[model samples]
Target: MARAPGFWFRQPGPWSAALAPLGAIYAAGTARRLSRGGRARVGVPVICVGNLNAGGTGKTPTVIALVQRLSDRGIRAHVVSRGHGGTEKGPLRVDPLRHAAARVGDEPRLMAAFGPVWVADDRVTGARAASDTGAQAVILDDGFQDPALAHDLSIVVVDAAKGWGNGRCLPAGPLREPVATGLARADMVLSIGGGHAQRQFAARWPALPVPHLTARLQPLKTGMDWTGLRALAFAGIGHPEKFFATLAREGVEIVRAEALADHQPFSPRLLTRLEGEARMLGAQLVTTEKDAARLPDDFRGKVLTLPARLRFDDPAELDRRLDALFD
Candidate 1:
C-alpha cells in the first residue's frame, strides 16, 4: 500500500491494542475472501511470488530469479502484475521503451527486462493474455491474496528478520493475512536475508508445514562498483532500510539515507531538493534499480543504481519443486 505504519513493526502497544478489533475484522475479511471457491484457472501454471506483509518483502527479485531459472529450462515465462502505482487498467504488454513506471508500475517495468510482462488490474485476464501469446508459464507478481487466478504454486516471500511483525494484521501489524492461515496455503516459504537474519528467522519458526527455502540478495555484478564510494542513498521502496543495508554490505560509504514511501512518485520539486542536498554533501546521488525506474530520463544518469538479484541457498530444491509442475 503506502508507507507502512511504524507501530506495525514495533512491539504491540496501546495503538495496536486499540486497533486489535479492526485488525480482527480485516483478518476475517481476508480469510472469507480467500476461502471462496472458483478461483479461475489458466492453461499454464500460475506461480505467485507474494508475501504476508502488505508491502514489499523481496518479491520482485524472487520473480526475476524464477523467470531467469525458468528461461534456462526453455520455458517462455510471462509476468502478470496488478500495476499497483499505475493508471492503466489493462492486459497491456509492458514495453520498457514506451511504458514508464507511472503507467505500468516500477516492479513490472523491472521485470519486463527479464521477460514479457503484462500490466492488468484483472490478473486472470493478464495471465490468459500471456498464455495466448505463447507463455509456457505465467508468474503472478504479488497476487497471493487476490485469488484472481488459481495458482499451481504459491511461494510466500518474507523478510527473515521481520517475521510477521508482532503477528497481527493491518493497522495492528504488518501482515496482510495471519501467519498460520497464510502458511497453510503456501507451497513454499522463501526467507530472504543474510545468514544472521536467516538464523533468527529459523529460531522464530522452528518447524514450518511447507518447504522452507532460503535466499539472499546479492549485487547483480553490473560492473558498476560502489565500494568505498561516498554516496547519498535514497529509495522509495517498501523497506528502504533493506536497500541501505545492501549498500552497506557492498562497502558504500553512505553520506545520507532518504527513505520515502513505497512506490513514491518522484516529482521535479523532490528531485531538485535531493540534487541540492547531494551538491552540498559532495556525494553522488544513489538509489536502488527499482527506484531508478521511476526517475526522469534527464535525471536518471545522475543517480547511481545498485541492482541486485536473489540467489537461492538450495537451487536443487527449487528445481525439484518447479520440475514437479512440469511433470
Candidate 2:
C-alpha cells in the first residue's frame, strides 16, 4: 500500500484542493452505500472498533483490549477481521499456532493470541461463524465502514497524533468516509495517545454527543532488560515512528530505526540485509508485536518483540460502557 499523502495531515493544500472533487464523489458513494442498510445480524452483540481514516488508528490494539475486558467479565468474545495483506478470503477461524501471517494477516494472527479470531472479507459470514462457534459477543476490527453486518455498538478510534488528516476523503485526503457521517453513527470516540490533533478535533466538533475516551499504548514487559541495550529497531506499521518513539521512552538505545510500509511483506533477502545491519552495529534486533508476527520462523528467535496494551485514562468509564453492552 502507498504511504498516506503528507497533505492529509496539513490544512487543505493545493493538492488536496485539486482532488476535492474526487473526494466528494467518494464521500457520496459511501453515504449512499450506508443508506441501503439491510445488514445481517448475528445472535450475539457485535461491537465495531473502526476508524474514519484509511490508515491505522490503533484498531487492532483496541480490539485486543476490548476482548480482554470481555473475557474479564466472563464474556466469550470472538474477533472478526477482513484479514488485510493476507491471501485467505474466507470465513475461517484463525489458528495462531497453525496459520502464518502470510495466510491469515498480521492483525488477525496477533488477535488470535488474545481470543478466537475469524477472517473473512464478508464480515457477516465471519460474525455468523463466531456466533455458531459459541461466542457470546463478537468484536469487528476495522468494520465500521462495512455495512453488511449489523453492529450493536460502534466505537471509532482516532490516532490523537493524526486526527482526521486534513479531513478529506479517499484520493484527496486520508478519510475513508466523511468524519461527520462517521461521528453521527458512532456510539463512542476513542482517542489514543496524547497530541494536539485530538484536541483540535474535539474543539472542531464540540456538538458531538458521543462519549469520549482517552487511552495510551503501554508497552508490556518483555522480561529482557532493555536499559543500556543497543538495538536496531524496525517496524512495518501504519506509523513506524510511533514504535520508535515507544522504544525511546523505554530507554532502549536505538542504533538505527527502519520504517517500512504498513504490512510490508518480509522477504528472506530483506531479513538478511536487516540482520547484517544489526550485526554491523553490534545491536540486537527489536520490533513491534505486529511486525514480529509477520517474521518467518527462522528469524523469530533472532528478533525481540515489543508487545503493548491499551491503558484507559478512566478504567471505570470503560467498564461501564462495556457492562452496558453486555448487560
Candidate 3:
C-alpha cells in the first residue's frame, strides 16, 4: 500500500477539512456495506484481527500472538488472508517454501511460518477452507470491514502512539470507518506500544467502550545478539518508522535507515542497489521478518532479520474471551 498522507495524522487543517465531504461519503458507503445481510459462518469459530485505520496497526503481529496463544492451549488455528499484495485468486494453502510473497503476499507468507494459512480474495471461501482442513479455529486477517463472514470475535488493533489519526475516516484521515461506528462492532481494542505509549493511549481513551488491551513487540530470541551491531536497516511496511524505532531500541548502530513502500517488491536491481549502499557504509543489511519473506531467493539468507513477536501486557481478559468461543 502507498504511504498514507501526512495530513491524515495531523489535526483538522486545510487538507482534512477540504476532504471532509469525501470522507463522509466514504464512511457512509462503509456503513451500508457492513449492514448488508447474508453474512456466512464457517463450522469453526473465526477470530478476526483487524484495524479501524486503513494502514497497518500491528495486525500481523496481533494475529501471530493470538495463534500462538491458541496453540498453547492445544487448539489448531489456521490463518485466512485476502492476499492483499499478491496475484493469487483462490483459497489455496500457503507453503512458505513453494510460495513467494509475489504469489501469496508478504503477510500471509509470514503468518504461514507459524501455522496453516489460506489466501483467497473471497474471505468467506478461505474461512471455509480453513475449517475443512482441521483448523479448530480460524484467524481471519484484516477483514473487519467485510461482512461476508461473521466473526465470533473481532479485534481492532491500533498503534498506541498513532491512535485513530485525526479521528476521521478515509481520504480525510487514516480511519477506514468512523471511530464510534467501528468500535460498536469490535469485541476488543488492542493498542500496541511501549509503557509510555500505552499509558498515553489509555489516558487518551479512558472510556474506550470495548475491552482495551495493550502489548509491545519484543524480538524473538535467535541467539544473534543485536547490541552495538552496525547495520543499514530497511523496512517496507505500513509504518517503517516503527521498524527503525525497534532497531534503535535493540541497540543497533544504524548507519542509514531506508523506508520503502509497504510490501515493496524486491527486484534484483533494488537488491543490488541496497547491497551496494550497505557495503559503502560498512554496515550489514538488516530488515524486518515480514520483509524477509519477500526477499529474492539468493539474498534471503544474506540479509539479517530481526523478528519481533507481540507480547500482551495481560492476556487474562483476552483468554476469557477466547475461552468463551468454545463454551
Candidate 4:
C-alpha cells in the first residue's frame, strides 16, 4: 500500500531525507521530456486532458465537461481512454447502456453519454476507432504521460487540495511527473477548488505562459436523506477521505468505512465480505460512481452509487475555451 502524504511528510528520519536526491533526478528527466512539443499529425484533431499526479484530479469530469461544451458548438467529439481497470483486449467502442463498467471501464462509460467513447490499451488504435465513428476531434483522457499520440492541445488538471504533495515522484510523493514538466507542456492549467494552492501556483509559476482557470468540486444533488439509516461507505478513488467527507455532508451515518486502492477491480468474494460487514453493522453499502462501475453485475444493484458532476461557476468561460481549441 502507498503511504499517505501526511505519513511521509511528517517523517523526519534519515531514510526520508535520503530520497530527496533521487527526486531531483526524477524531476530533471520529467522536465526534459515535457519540454518537447507534443505535435500530432492525425487526420482528426486531438485534445488531451491529463494531470501531473498518478491519481484523480477531476480529469474524467473535465472530459465530460469538454465533450458537452464541444457538442454545443456543433463539434462532434469522441473520447479515447486506456480503460484503466476494465478487463478487455484490443480497441472497443463503449456503448454506455450495453457496456457495463466491467467491460469498458467507468470513465469511458460516463464519457459515452456526451459522444462516442472508445477504449484500448493501444491509444493509437483507440484514436482510429474514434475517427471511424465520425468524431471530428478526439479527447484523449489522461494522456499527458502518453507521448505516442500527437496532441494538438494539452490541459493539465491539478487537485488544488493536494498540490504536488512534497513535490516528489513515485514512492517519495504522489506526482507521476514533476510540476514544471507538466506545466511546460500544458496549454492551460486548471486548478480545482478555490484554495491557497491555486493562488500560490499563480504567484510562483507566473512565467509558465499558460492560462489558469479555477474550478470547484460540486455535489451532484442538493441533498440525500440518511436519517435513521445506518450506512457502510466504501470507495476505490484517489482519496477515500473525499468520499467519506461527502457522505458526512449528506448526513449519512457511516457505521463502517472502508477504502480500496484507486481503480480496484471488484470481485464477488470482496463484495461478499463487504455485504457481510454491512449486515453485521446493520447498514447498507454505499460507494462512489467509479467504484460502483467496477462491481460485478450481481452486486451492482445492492450498492448505492453517488454520481457526481464537474460544475463550473462561470461555465461560459469553459465553453469559450473549447471554441478556442477548434479555432
Q: Which candidate has the highest TM-score of all?
A: 3
Candidate 1 contains a number of clashing pairs equal to: 0
Selected candidate, larger TM-score, 2 vs 4: 2
Ranking by TM-score: 3, 1, 2, 4
Lowest summed-lDDT stretch of 10 residues in model 4?
1-10
Q: Give the TM-score of candidate 1.
A: 0.97
| Per-residue lDDT of 66 in model 1 | 93
Please report the candidate that would top lDDT against the real structure: 3
Poorly placed runs, candidate 1 (over 4 Å):
none
Write one digit per residue (lDDT tens) for candidate 4, span 1-327.
232556333334455457767766776776676566654455888989998876877898888888887887889888889887677665898887788777788778767777888888888788888888798899999878776788877888877667566666655666767677667778887877645656765664465667777787666774666554678999888778777877777778889889888777677788889999999988999998777766777788888877777766565555666677678
**CA lDDT of each prediction against the hidden true structure:** 0.90, 0.90, 0.92, 0.76
Name the candidate, 1 or 4, with the larger TM-score value: 1
Residue 305 shift from truth in candidate 4, angstroms: 1.3
- The list of candidate 3 runs beyond 4 A from truth reads none
TM-score of each model, in listed order: 0.97, 0.96, 0.98, 0.86
> Which pairs clash in the backbone of model 3?
none
Off by over 4 Å in 2: 195-207
RMSD in Å for model 1: 1.2
User: RMSD, model 3, all Cα superposed?
Assistant: 0.9
Off by over 4 Å in 4: 1-16, 24-39, 96-103, 194-209, 222-228, 315-317
In candidate 2, clashing pairs total 0
Give a tens-digit lDDT track for model 3, residues 119-142: 999999999988987999999899
The global Cα lDDT (0 to 1) of model 3 is: 0.92
